[model samples]
Target: MDLQVLDFPGGKVAFTSKMQFISETSEKRVPCYRVLDDYGQQIEYDCSAQVNEELAVKMYTDMVTLQIMDAIFYEAQRQGRISFYLTSMGEEAINIASAAALTNDDIVLPQYREQGVLLWRGFTVQEFANQCFGNKVDYGKGRQMPIHYGSNKHNYFTVSSPIGTQLPQAVGAAYSLKMDKKSACVAAYFGDGGTSEGDFHAGLNFAAVMEAPVIFFCRNNGWAISTHTREQFRSDGIVVRGQAYGIRSIRVDGNDALAVYSAVREAREMAIKDQRPILIEALTYRVGHHSTSDDSTKYRSMDEIEYWKMSRNPVNRFRKWVERNMWWDDKREVELRNDIRNQVLRAIQTAEKCEKPPLSDLFRDVYDTLPSNLHEQESQLRETIKSYPKDYPLDVPV
Candidate 1:
């Protein structure tokens, strides 16, 4: 019944006489921090001081813009104008508010659903359309599919389709900033499902060991494609995982815009100050299908989706907060929605009308000088197209 300290290879340990194991489930689960209630009323604390009229208005407006843009783009996919599309219907607050909290210098490695981050970084709807449509003027040269947006000028990395790949990459970037003594951190955004990937665990451990300044933003929207969080893991969500890696972690109500902004702002400060990683598990709902390819109703009930969409819609929630402060009104709401819709429509129309990238573009960018094999293939392709003119479209430049 005597307590004794044990020498261990790992580190110091406090010996205890009692034998106990950590339980998977706890009566007092990790609390999710939230600044506003579902009705958009600030409960225990008022965040109006930090979230001013101008900032609040801009956050709400950007959320609406993202919502509208998603709707238009999703429909465009349905109409066959674009190949594929994904909508950030309910998670608008997470995208816009978190982005507003960080400086432009901070690097962003986003998953596919983070279009709002690009929008916050001044990426126009035209750019979104160009990429989705894979038009001639598209920055990616029509290589990637829709929504794989990246802007070097904005310090945001191009989105990769592979799940959880950005997690470790963010840590590497953060480590580079640490080495350079730069005043910046990397923000890596991923879904709840991404935690299951090996990269996620590796990335967290690396960041903790290296004392890298990075924000691991997990948009725990309850689902990863068709799979629900119930199927992902059983350890009380992703926050505790961060604790296991010796990194700071917090869970916040992702639907609450002000809460997200406040949390990210403080997280950034602590991340850079301490030269460590911070994991933010944002508790929100995926109110839309995972992508245009998915029909969410097949896996989840319409009533379930409707509940989050109607009662806890992030955009509507923030709008209420903004209106309560007299920062928003119905006239502005109407104009904002209409103007965004028109802009989206015009962008889509122009993108659709634009030509595809030239055929020669396919061979460029890989190397300074094309290899003999590639040059031969290019010549053969040109000859084949000439022979079978009907097989190829004439619009692509020779």
Candidate 2:
């Protein structure tokens, strides 16, 4: 194959062109775009509710419910009722509003913390408890970890534990949707930390080149498990990377529900109509510990967390907006908090009482037909259980 030299208006490139060159234009900082201010109030421009009153109320209600659910579940993990857990503490708006902006048919590839997306799509509190508890009713049949949730009916993919694997998977799924001539698009959610992974680059490049209808939603919550965004990347956050890959992108106030909703709504439309990828970098903070395994205070200050909690809480900001609109009241707020608390407690109790997945489930779902090796292993396990029935009560065949 012959290598051809290409000439352009400002520059010429050839196989022998030196890779090292300084471009002052590329070094400029890109401004973060936002539609709403810290108070959930529209800033320079107005973006009215894209949804009607009923849907608007529902979105607000879900955000409050999600906050309550996170409180209870985090407590459950501390009490050792569940093995582990992750909460969408400060990113509720980014989760719920973004979900509200998409149709039910759109696919969601979530990182572990975006449980609000699943909940907004009608995943019941009981179902969440079931999965976290790894009970018989869990859709994963107790196979996945506590926060790894998925629903085919809801068009949400099962979350993988690997950090950046979902980015490529979302691109592939969007490509399939394009090939099928479907109107839907795929949304993949990841944190700022995921940008450090190789898959993020490959996925974005492929999506842009192939014109896959997908949204790469990066929740830049300023921390990737205690490593702050400053140390994560030297670029102007994740948004500039999208421009580098020739993908349209935006940055939004992640704490402002209205801003996030508006940004995602437009992104979805452009993605479906233009058959291209869009990147969203949601600027927010993580108010809670990264997970049950982490102690956030070890690295971050209580004063910093308190500042975000008091000044930029997404739930409180959205609540204030709803209150100003006369769509919510103090009495309703009290009622909602109490109602969600009771529901969460009830679901936790029910899930804890449910039986664990049967021992046979371990061998099932691996393949269409159980391999001879697995069958032999299953038989050996059963015999061992039979020999120590009391010690293996949960493994006893029903």
Candidate 3:
């Protein structure tokens, strides 16, 4: 899985032979690996070995579920049910395919938009709703905002608000696993926008030097909020950065679910066997806005979004594959989608009806034993709430 290439213009450093400077973009760039064409037909190579009917159906269904979940939740935010929301639209393959490749033991450090990974690991739709609604049932205990989900049982780290913070954390976790002789590796996921952060470079360098088994998975969907990736950097993309850090790297077609699955599966093997870091830059698009807070039309054209949705959607592409293989039909599609929608609506209703976490949770979860300062603050808070009872909702247990 490791790609060997020259570091400089020449094979080795020469005193006077053909001096050259790095170009903004190179003609000879890293190639993107694709297993299927736009029609979901195999592109020369047979992908059945990498993705069979059973696995393909699961991946497709999971991706569809993710699509339905994101849409319904995004709408819920707009309708004032949730505070905020973000989506992995046009990047579903990057989520579920890569997730399917890894074992349950692999620790996940995710950026905000990798919900499909959580779904594949058995984090139920109700769990998603619980976290988004910030209900008492959420494992995070309503401490964080919507979608900042975590689960110790799933071995997935809770997502944070800060960009690129997970990169370093993933590296440290991988190093710990290495030193402890654990069989598992770490999958650190971030977006192209995160590459600009200093943490990205530091994490890659640390993992490379320490020979930690970690995979740096970048969903390069061409935008970080409002800034396009081209403006974010001038290099050929994220793959070349791995070369600079002495890490094995590959660029995969993020829309092609088979390619993503195979690339990540093999990458994991190489990372664990060699005890070295690997980088995968999954090229895709962001058809939806950055989040419920953003209107993508301000920066990108509606035509462009429509083109990707119609011509290059990962979900549609996978559905085509299943249809061609005789494993799917219109009836199944209709039933599956309608059921997912109903389940998501039910989840939202249940989550909304659940009580919010107790007011004491704000101070109780952070420490083993409550400090005197926190105790005093809690006391003051209780006293204030008691005096001004009407101002604070009584339903929120004091």
Candidate 4:
């Protein structure tokens, strides 16, 4: 019996198809592709693509919702209403479409930028508001910052600040799911920058060796913070990382909502039915800063951002497809945007007025039994709050 080794770095496999196949002893596996060009036309892939009016409209609505939320939250941060914010300005399709393909039982391990997924997964606007504003109603209390929303109901893991950590966690979760003989899988989302981390490799290798059901979804938006993909890696893309793990992988146009949805739908099917871990590299671009904290202008030019905006706008491309199919109207689009904006504004206003989580709420969840040292520190902090001036925001009952 002979085993095939793919030398991705040495250029042994000819990178022609969405997936390259090697003649391993007996079994054969293949990759899937569905990419579209700037004109909303298929470019690199030519498989039988399927999308209908309902899915198209749903995708459009999700994209619009994400855009509206992103725009408002950025302004909220600017107005000092929120401590931190992250936007999925350009990568809307990659997040929402991929999420649209998952089951309610499937777990989603998302990085900070995939706020769109939660919203699409029945996370009400008010829940988003509560989480972002860190109001009394917030599930995590006031611990996580804006957009770090999670829900057990949705099977979406909480978004953590550390990069690439979710990859391994997703692998472990999938391992558990498989051990329990469940059909559900875990889809972990990460950025191209995260691909450089050791966690990415460890997670992929574990999933591959264990045959865990997980989807390693990478949004190759060309930048990892201020660094470009060329700087982060020299391989074909994040997809090749999947090849190294001997996992089935796909690459799609991240801006094309249909392609993204179709690719993920197929990937999810493979994951659940075959217990295969998949790596999907969505070739997209980040049209915004690394976050509200960093100025992209420091590292990239205005011209570059403008280039992606005009030519590769996911919203615009999807809108074009919508118009071409006559499933959407310009007047309705305007009205929808206005309605969403007003909805967000009202949610924000209500969330802002909601009481902050009780000062003691923070000390409750840390341990089964609080250590004396931590209890003392918590007490000292409470005392300091009690010592604040009457006008201070500290409303704890001392």
Candidate 5:
């Protein structure tokens, strides 16, 4: 059934101001949900038998790959090989588990941190390396900086740096799916800080009013840049915000892969079959610096990071779960690491040596018929590059 049209209790003018004040006041303390104990035991969320051995192993593999990739990229940044990097260190469960629960046809709109989802859904290691290195073979032709990756092949919408922009775009995509009568959904991922943006409100309102087939996936990773959740808003966390929009919502222990996967599975089914919008707020933490440029240690303690690392490590917990079911070996852990490490090394080598894209690339894709102004801009850019020394090559194709 569709949600009843939302109305202002005190009518438009009075309710508008009240709503703003209430939203502001409630921002300081948000309730968080957890289906898994700190020990990684599943608390009460339902996991269907369909979440069988094969799926568990695959999820584990994806999580491992994500962790390895993050670590490798961090090293690359540290070694001055790459300009920047972001770590999904503590939230591997949010990335892999959610992707694992989705169908191939579903669209994913990710915030920058959710690369693991794309990798899980068949994004290649080489492709990832290409984007990271801004190599000639990069899909974006070195225009986008490292980690700003996208792929139409896997139905992942290109990520936008402007926070909360994807929320409305996801709503639009979901509406389109509804119009096409497609049995698929769109999942929009964002951080808790993004919840405070106007785009987030607009997107949720549009989805609720139109009954768009979208899942609003918020990774409440405890901090948005240097701003803690307490500072971001006073509300009962991101999940409760969904209730005002009439969207069915839940909060899950984001470090727990099973809990995250199970919530996503149920949300996806509902969105696909019923053209409903769901909001899932994942309670997790950011275990590393915000990016290569930021020092989280200045804002948080070593003990806090260590606490999450040792007690709530998503990768380790999933490994334990797999062991619990006797589906995998702890020794395969070594083999898995070697295989992935080698793969990443090779991909980095290939990406590093590859040239950047051609100068013509800047002008090619914006429009079918380039405007005279853009044509002139392209020419100016080419000439500027040509003026530089041969060793400082700029016009060279990636």
Candidate 6:
């Protein structure tokens, strides 16, 4: 079929009968963009240290701290101390390095695993324990599930469990920032499985058309729960979808801290200066189970998990890079790990001992003035607790 044309008041519209498609064969052959190798050595181009020695060491330190924190908290969940938890594990570089590239003022809307971002922004280990235990000190007042962390003080939005919802929210926030002439951009993180959602398409399209200053960081970590990437999509991963929406995109070696840091730094510049969205597909593997409830051995081979864990450990790779730069050593590594483990353990104990939120907290935040029905319910609950103090000893007075 040949081209067809139609004339309109503003301009002529042309259409072609030819169908352009990215077939599975072509997608399989698409090359992933990578800067650093498994050993943290440059692959092709030199990605020299843009940050000084202190910042470089700090990034590596945070990654190790995250690793240790995840291990301890994951054990806590298994030991029945916490209800649930998710670990950054193999993707620490993707979390901390990209975070290192952003300023404190930049807004971060993260998926659950990007807790390292908040940690880098100074969200303390104790706050993590508080949220996990859902104690009175938790910022959400024991309202949110464990691991769904947020901090307005750090400009990080609270994580929502419903996948892909944050994409549009990030774009909307970015649009508002653009209108307000703010100097910061928004960075939203989601998994590869999130790309399958309608919200992902809607968010990307809206951001592209509106030229919103947002970065869509997709952590293509091999598995979406039990479903592998091969079963998830037939295209050349999530990065290609960005191009389909006329947005600039790149795929980076997610395990390599330098690669992730460099790509995100450039992406932030493009997003803020150009007022456009950028998609980053970080090619990494999820070495741990999806969450505490998940048993990955049921779906994946232990051998494959061990391979990624031993060979592509992001923390080890970055540590090697920093050590090569003469800024880190085994003594510092030991001291940091010991300190983090002790801190996490102490925080967990403290959070558990803290009291639960008062019953009134539930009715307080929903409305300015309490509704009659809720008021009655609150009163009845209080009366019941007052009458049966033995049965409701933990319940606090309104």
> On residues 124-183, what C-alpha lDDT tens digit does candidate 4 reach at each position?
888898999998898988788788888989898988888899988898999999999897
Q: Please give the CA lDDT of all the candidate structures.
A: 0.92, 0.89, 0.92, 0.84, 0.86, 0.89
TM-score each candidate.
Answer: 0.97, 0.93, 0.95, 0.88, 0.90, 0.93
What's the true lDDT of residue 380 in model 2?
Answer: 93
Write the number of the candidate with greater lDDT, choosing between 5 and 6.
6
**How much is 273 displaced in model 5, in angstroms?**
2.3
> What are the clashing pairs of model 6?
none
lDDT of 1 by residue, 336-366 (tens): 9999999999999999899999998889778
lDDT of 6: 0.89
Residues 1-398, model 5: lDDT tens digits: 22343345854332232334333545344545555565556566545625689898899988898899889989999999989889899999999999998987999999999998998999988999999988778888888879999999999988778999998889899999999999899999999999989999999999999999999999999888899998999777888888899999988889888888889989998887888899999988899889999999888899998998888788788787787778889688889988999998898888998888876777877889888999899888768666764645653662
TM-score head-to-head 1 vs 6, winner: 1
The C-alpha RMSD of each candidate to the native structure, in angstroms, is 1.8, 3.4, 4.0, 6.0, 4.7, 2.7
lDDT of 3 at 52: 80
User: Which ranking of candidates, highest TM-score first?
Assistant: 1, 3, 6, 2, 5, 4
Candidate 4 vs. true structure, TM-score: 0.88
Q: For candidate 3, write residues 1-398 as lDDT tens digits.
A: 22343357645442544678867666888899998899999777744346788998899999999999999999999999999999999999999999999999999999988999999999999999999998999999988999899999999999999999999889899999999888889999999999999999999999999899999999999989899987999888999999889999999999999899989998889889899999999999998898888999999888989999889999999889889999999999999999999999999999999999999898985789899999999999999988999999755778
Worst 10 residues of 4 by lDDT: 23-32
Per-residue lDDT of 1-398 in model 2, one digit per residue for the tens?
Answer: 34566677956667555677656346566666665566666567555546566777899999989999999999999999999999999999999999999999899999888999999999999999999999889999999889989999999999889998999889999999999989999999999999999999988999999999999999999989989988998888888888889999998889988888988998999999999999999989999889999999999999999998889898888887777778889999899999999999999999999998888888997999999999999999889777877876563243
TM-score between model 1 and native: 0.97
In terms of lDDT, model 3 sits at 0.92
Give the CA lDDT, 0 to 100, for residue 263 in model 1.
Answer: 92
